[model samples]
Target: MPKGKRKGKFEHRRTEEKIYSSDEDAGIDMTIDNCSETSGQSDLKSAHDDAENEQEKLEEKVLEMIDALSARSNAARAGAMVSLRNALQRRHLAAVLCNQRATLADHLAKALRRGRDGERRAAAGLAPLLALQIGEEGVEEFVNEIRPELAAAAADKSASLETRTEVMSQTFTYV
Candidate 1:
């Protein structure tokens, strides 16, 4: 057989050649052909399974971090809250967190109310992201639950301006 040619059962024949006007056209054609080869239902199912597995792992990690919020070391607790806040940025993770919004919010609120300065700051930062993850109705409920405490904290002259501002902005503005 000649180069770039194939033999059939009956006889040897020239393969049809595709002509492209530009390298970009050639690239597009190659992409289309490659895509067709991998566009089977199995490929889609496998991709979906992978996505679900990743989501599960992410959810597990977020839960672990939330548990870590109660660690004896302030640094560990602050780190966990920060991690939870970062995880909330992912929509899938956020949805998972939202499922436990009441528990999460209550825990963070306690931290904001009674923890040391660093823990309070971490809780302050995570509060808005938690509200956003829980959606409008959930956020409204959270705000209602914490509104009085937040107002008290905001008005308390002893509280640092940053802490008061965090409480007011995160609770009221976001809700």
Candidate 2:
């Protein structure tokens, strides 16, 4: 996916099989669009093709991990996502990460649609990274997009405190 596509804030469901890119600048995105779902077959094919096209072992590893995460079990999916996101940034898979932005965003949007607690929190982490290249104003727009939900969420105790804290803190980042 292109970096520009994930700009601002958005939503997605978190899942073990979902593939999230680590290009997030500040964290989760808040942009809303009629994001469509893509086929698993295509995502699998894309990851496979990425591996074949890249000779760099490190880049290949990123693709390999993405493929692996795409099929991971739900019990381990959230942790797996965090690991993948961390790897994207920590391993510096800038080229592939930038290229996979669309796929990642699609998958993320789907995750948010799932409406699970874990998925939302995982999605939150991507907002910052999504708008990183777009600069602060974009980030502000992104944060403002999701602030209401975050604030309202903070008032609810059923969700994880991390979710509320992340969202509320996001308000500070944008405001």
Give lDDT per model, in order. 0.72, 0.55
lDDT of 1 by residue, 1-175 (tens): 6864655753433335555578667565544444554567779889999998988888888889878977888778888998887777655455666577788777776777677666766787787777667776577787666566566655656667777777667556644
TM-score of each: 0.67, 0.45
Cα-lDDT of candidate 1: 0.72
Which candidate leads the pack in lDDT? Answer: 1
Q: How many backbone clashes does candidate 1 have?
A: 0
lDDT of 2 by residue, 1-175 (tens): 7865663334333333466567354465657443445666677789998876764876676666555545445435455556666765654455666655555545444444443567556655654555463344344454445555545545656767776676556446544
What is the Å distance of residue 125 in model 1 from its true position?
Answer: 1.9
Q: Highest TM-score among the candidates is held by which one?
A: 1
RMSD of 2: 29.4
